[model samples]
Target: MKNNKIFLIGLLAMVFLTACNEDVLEYKPEGLLSQADVSTTENLEGLVIAAYAGIANDEMVGPITHQWVYGSVRADDAYKGGGGIGDVDVINRYEMYNLTIPDYGDWMTPKTWVNHYKAISRANFALELINEASEADFPKKTLRQAELRFLRAHSHFMLKLLFKKVPYIVETMTAEEKANATNDMTNDELWNMIADDFLFAYNNLPQSQDEVGRADRSAAAAYLAKLRLYQAYEQNDTHQVTSINPARLQEVIDYADDVTGALEPDFGNNFLDGFDNGSESIWAAQFSINDGTLVSRVSFVTGLNSPNSTELYGCCGFHLASQNMVNAFKTDTNGLPLLDTFNDVDIFDSVDGNGKAPLAPGITLDPRIDHTVGIPGRPFKYRNTVNEAGDMIYNFSWARDPGVYGYFGNMKEQQAPDCSCYVKEGPFVGTSKNVDFIRYADVLLWKAEALIQLNQVSQGIAIINRIRDRAANSTNRPINAGATDVYAIGTYPLTLSKEDALKALKFERRLEFAMEGARFFDLVRWGQAAQVLNGYVAVEKTKRDFLANAQFTAGRDEYYPIPQREIDVTGGLYTQNPGY
Candidate 1:
């Protein structure tokens, strides 16, 4: 993940090159496979598989399966916690939202740009092969090609989210065309191009695949729904939503209607290792441990996020939850969230509903907090049974630097140290549990957001309350042993106004997907990133000194600056994002 470790993630083509050092003996490297070795008509599937692997590869610093740095740290859901602000300081730069120019010499975002393109390149390479072959020659030609394009669009979509004006590349492009592909396309055009790939996949892919990891029709539909939802919030050059397109909102609802996925019966089922490809998982990046590979295909995105307990998770604790996020879960007398005044008090010291009384048994909060965050003196990952390290309660000592970041750790993506899926590589802990890119809950929420934007207020609130209902029933936890409350969470009434429904819908998303790396992007989509995040830092700076100088610039900070290295590699053809 560091600059020194960059070579380990060499492009897909690097494996095909003949490394013939003239002075040394070189005979095509005995164990390596050549392009011809894997490119035969019968083995064309190999190229497709390689494309999947390109996206599946996870490293903490790169844009891994879960984009914790881009989504969580950039938003109000989390703080970039580690040894200090200097530990993986590029993320610290991101958290602070300044000195993050294209040529700032930070490798994290640039490496993420490269990693996405690597995945895109693999898809293009496979597409080039498939384009020449007929369905008669390759029986699964259309199906495989659709899947490859789905992967290609996925990478481009993530790139668009991170850096808005990324060049859209395809297999049809000539060498010159590829070289000169610039970040000049209008937002609508680029979004349409990415959506075109998903549109094709949605039309061609089957409803199910023999391999659980493979993309299916429902996955394509879900992605199309997601794409349309983002596209609906039409933004200008300044990255502010100019208008919410009603047609696009309708498309989100229609595409969502085609998505045949369901929420897990219990909310906790979605995060458990045993439910990797459960009903709730519309599409996920499959991972594994003890699969006979050198180090196992375990998730490395949150590798640095395990608790710093030596006997337990071992190393760094990075993506810790924010006080604003924890407080967002607390409910008032009606058991509804305290939307406006939630962040008035820190999680460690919460006042009563009126903001006058100290915390007591009556400070009811959503039980999903028990599942999303790890608090000291509380059960970790719903486990009261002792772990292999002989600890169940989240120890206060597990936090790496609570003085820098609050004493809350991200919990949804993590596993217990004793679990078979758990693997500790040195100090970092990783799990083989699949990371959901599109959860059934996400599909429902996307429709809800679009509906609210389109003025279907009650329908949107109805959809959001489904998630809250699941949260209320997710109280099957190790009895919360902390001083904070975990009493009750209630659903919203249907009589709410459109504006209140929008607020409730957005709040529901923040609480439901709190630590799953989606908050910041949601804020950006809603054009509320600056107001919400700057307010978060204003209060957070008082508690954490590292955020004293933090600020979120409206025009520039909406999207990350285009990587300078990308522009250099393109012969300066790529234009940097605005304000960079």
Candidate 2:
């Protein structure tokens, strides 16, 4: 019997006969169309949609769009919380920086390189085809070109951060030209090349787009600020920051000023499903479910990170909050973070097997903790609303393997299991929620960073305090406000010294953006990866034995080794990054 409700994905394929190779259709092979047939204006615009789809192709482990593994698990923010050490061995190796492994055939490394290049190829193809069309045929030719360039630059920026040195591919390059391309650009030159794309995008893109998902001038401005912030830390071939570029820091401030209302009034709004594209959002990858489509465009990339069998969410659990992260939320008697001694006490000390850990009476924590992480006895997201029957609980029995991975659940990525947005695809669970690639809070933090590096330490402290003040007042808490847990957060001291101000800024970012996949990258840019991570390993090893022998080498651990498959494809044209 044929099922009428079952839809086929074959109807949505996009076929392109490229001048370089007819085999290019392997990536997206649905509709049959020739490149020569792409001369019409409508066909040119369709190419842009195809380019946008590339970012959504992220599933499981995309080094481009999803950073759960690379940025969070690889840092101190999260642990590889699956079944056990042998569950996903490659990821476990990555968590330990076990690069000495001879076999680099893991699926993530090559898949990351391939998926990003696939997006680049589409943008390059679109650009060439758009050029062939007349301005009369496509009146918005410049705008389309600008959009495609932004996509291309975005892909390159993702690659640069993950691989450090990647070939700069453009539409001007032929198939033969690209095959012979190499990752030979100097660090400074590579950054400038990426900056050029964002600069072009900033000048040509409109202030707002008619489409909800399109990148606008403000998005371009925000991206340029991010790029400039990274560029301001001038690094040498060895991946060490040689000097700080003052002019580049100034550019960050200049570009940040051009961005409007990038910071939302409430931090909770940024994590909700519907308010994803709000004014505070600089840019986000769009997702839709039940929108007359066969399947959702939802991000299944972090599917493995959901909670285990429970009433709230039934599935695997791959990314759990580290004890270090939980401890970092502890505040002093003055309602401020005990930055130096926060790690002295463990949050799990009072917990029993049922995952019930009651804080001492009058104990206070930042309200953001409930929004960012799911701890036992605490509400998950706003799941504890007044009208609901009960709260969405994070039960210790819900953990896949609590003996190894802790009982903490990731709240930011998962919706209530009973919510319409949650989709149960077999044993795994996913959600039709938009993923923010860059938000306004990120821009504000970047601005604060620039101010600190420019010697305006007081101004930087003020900006950091503003974020703290927001977190202190953020209302994303359990609806049934009880006296069990305290919510106390204080602003930074205005008379802070430069050294103290720097420490405060770093701590604030950790508390503000925990588990959102920005921790490792922040440490790297600050040139503190070695010191910070080594210290983390020392303390955490006493908690988890898998990390007892883990170490982070200064020169080697800064960037992941380029996939051996990519190097093989280049036929020795590409040189391996240092200490690979």
Clashes of each: 0, 2
In model 2, the Cα lDDT at residue 539 comes to 95
lDDT digits (tens) for residues 183-212 of candidate 1 = 898999999999999999999999978677
Q: What is the lDDT of residue 532 in candidate 2?
A: 92
Give lDDT tens digits, candidate 2, residues 1-580.
Answer: 1122211111222444222333331233234666666656767777777777776667786556768898999899999988898887788988988876323646776678778878777777788889777788888888988888998899899888888999888988776887788888898899999989888989999987867678788888989999999998888888888899999999999998888655667778778766767888777776666655566556688889887855555567889999899889889887789889888888744566656666766567877888888777666667655234245655567678877877777888877665666677877776767788888788888888899878898888888888887887786555223577778888877788878888888888899889988899988888899999999999999988878878999888888888776676678888788887
TM-score of each: 0.92, 0.93
Show where candidate 1 strays beyond 4 Å.
Answer: 1-37, 350-359, 482-484
Those runs of model 2 whose alpha carbons end farther than 4 Å from true positions after fitting are: 1-31, 101-105, 385-391, 479-481
